[model samples]
Target: MFTLPHHIEFLSDRWVEEGRKFLVGEAPKIRERPAPAERLRGRPLSVSGRFTQAPPHMNLPRDVGCFSVHFDGEAFAVTTSFDPAADLVIEGDYQAALTGAQMVGIAAPGAFRTLRREIDHLYGPEALKVRGAIADPMALEVLSGLFDHLGRKTVENPDLAHRAARQGLSGKIREMEAQGYTIVENAITPEFADEARETILRTLSMHGHQTMNWMLYHGRALERLALNPSLMTLIDASLGRGAVIASLSCIRRGAGPGFIPIHTDYSHVPEPYPAFAMTGVGVWAFEDWTEASGPTVLVPGSHRARRHPRSSDDPGAGVPIVMPKGSVVFFTEGVWHWQGDRTEAGERVTLHSHFNRGILRSLEARRIDEQMIYRNPPRLGEMLGEDDWFEKTTAAGRDYMRFNYMRQLLAFNEAGKQAILAEPQAAAPTKSARRAVPA
Candidate 1:
């Protein structure tokens, strides 16, 4: 397994040191590019960055929230101080700056355009500010290349590996691959589950509705649960990165016959579905799920059929997924499923988190609220489609920074999934061997 030496928080001192080393190592490659090489033939270039209002969890020092990069034609050096005489100075909200720095693999021609578009259209003018100018516009491209190189080594989904190991998710991932669905028992604490249930009930009462869409905007609990690390790892493995929120909905159902019919999630698609997955869902159980309490039932290994269930198919073959409170059942790859009848329950409450591949349109229209983005970490924004380049356009062209960002993110997510699957599964100890060991 590939394990990081230590957790490197974004924009921390360690992140800066690692970024410096990465830039130093990539200096030679940057010089090989003809246009950038010619642009920096003789003149030295310097750029400084300043960020403020960093989230408390980031642990960045208030006084040292700045860094400068200096390139002396052939070599590069990074320092933890502002450069008053630098050719360019970029300043912005700490989170917004992190967003800009995380965009990797952007082409030189679209670098400046991407930055300008993000500042004006996405982050707002007050969120990002740029000062000073270079005589040669090509310098922006060279600097952009340097930043991209650094970002490749630094910014990443930091919790994926540790969370997977902590939750023992490798076997779950394998199970999901083989059966098209998996249940993670006690994915959250019972206390949290109760809190989420109460929040949902309150929202339902306020809105006078049995079901609510856009539940992520309803409460903090929904937001946190929606971006659960373990659930996200599974989604990343199945849907690839840059997957946007298709819907975050809550349902309050009383004792009655199952209303939803047996079907696949892939609506309007032709038969013999493609090998790749298009959509996935993680249904959260707010209370213990029993066969009679109304649980989601699915046909095991049916995804391998690669088609929807026919009327002749036996619904009796489906098995109910029974799990404890705070658990979640994740199903993908167009699995055939339906809600079971509720005979014993007062009410069955569930929060459904549905996600689609980056290339597909979402079921719920995105409402890009700035306060919501500001309150949560970049992960929440990412699921809300803030990080990817979609539905964004200008008279000049598309946002290449986000376009390239999604490409790089998807590649990284796939590689990480493979690594998780490659890990060796530990064997259970034999009875005699267990007896020989000391208690």
Candidate 2:
């Protein structure tokens, strides 16, 4: 298990000195514009960069030194500071800045791998680059934290875990409607949970390493678990009769002090928290969610806020949703949540399934086909995204791609008049706006 504090100490005592010897000389040159000026001419786009020196002619407070690249309706303006706040901000290591600036709106043809290798060579010997160790859990945790700090804040939703105790699996759907989320205890049988756990472990062992696509390839238990009658019923009630599966993945947390930043799952879904459902997430806990084990922490009643909350807004607002092994937790994509600190020994795993109304596309659209469809039970056709509803586009030509789901699609298109109103227009930028640089 990797702990952030210990990793920070390690960096201070070891990595930093080694990095200084090479990184200082190898870092990319900070000029007025690293790329050509023509690339930004007349393009309606903007992005920001962080942790480096500010560009010339751009004024910012001494403390906040981020820079921006803007394309005002006509000309491109690259400067430091947010005069007209950028549409996106690129943050992370030097490579992120180079890649982001190079490919602003259009794709650029170049060998990104070669570029990275050349830069790493300048940073010093290969050991100082820390590439090989990134696969280690501790190293990955440390790298995640460093990038998060260098980049924009993940979520602005306040932590409201304090009010979680008020909910005890009563008035399940009603509670979700009022508060934007709810928890259901004993949602699955102990035997089912055990089977799912074994399936998950076996799949992991077969792969020999962790990758994002495991849920799509293996884990029959997970696919069956998604079709659980009770779980589907809950989703149907909230997202209407034809809620479809957006993604089905497993979350495993080994004994460590690993922490995921607070954020919402609204990336695919359109913003301006709607009155109805767009995307919903279900987390089936396979182990007891306790303080020592570091279960998920969420803000109670935050879904109604219709906006993402910041960690700084009220950090204490969050409470951990502790439950037994057979329990499942359901929340709208808008609800703010994050992984809590795990100080205990052993590994914790949860089956994560996200559902969206039929009008939206599935996150794992390509992975699910006729062969995989035949394996699941008949009742799961709609939720597993095996029906015609997933095939046809709405009258307004909007589905998961344009709008989030049915509710947002219907709300935005009233007959022919488009009601494209931005909710809480000032509630910070979307997650994409925060980290524009793709890793």
Task: Please provide, for model 1 over 71-185, each residue's C-alpha lDDT reduced to its tens digit, 9 standing for 90 to 100.
Answer: 7887667877878778989887665565556544455455445545543433455878889976665666666566665444344343344335534676677667767887777
| Global Cα RMSD, each model | 14.7, 24.6
Deviation in angstroms for 104 in model 2?
50
Candidate 1 TM-score over all chains jointly: 0.64
Which residue runs does candidate 2 get wrong by more than 4 Å? 1-170, 214-217, 268-271, 390-439
List the candidate 1 regions with Cα displacement exceeding 4 Å.
1-163, 424-439
What is the TM-score of candidate 2?
0.49
Considering every candidate listed, which one attains the maximal TM-score?
1
- For candidate 2, the 10 contiguous residues with the lowest summed lDDT are 154-163
Put down candidate 2 lDDT per residue, 316-416, tens digits, no spaces.
77767777787777888488888888888898977787888766777775455564554433334545554333454768763443233334423322311
Query: Which residue pairs in candidate 1 have backbone atoms (N, alpha carbon, C) closer than 3 angstroms, thus clashing?
Result: none
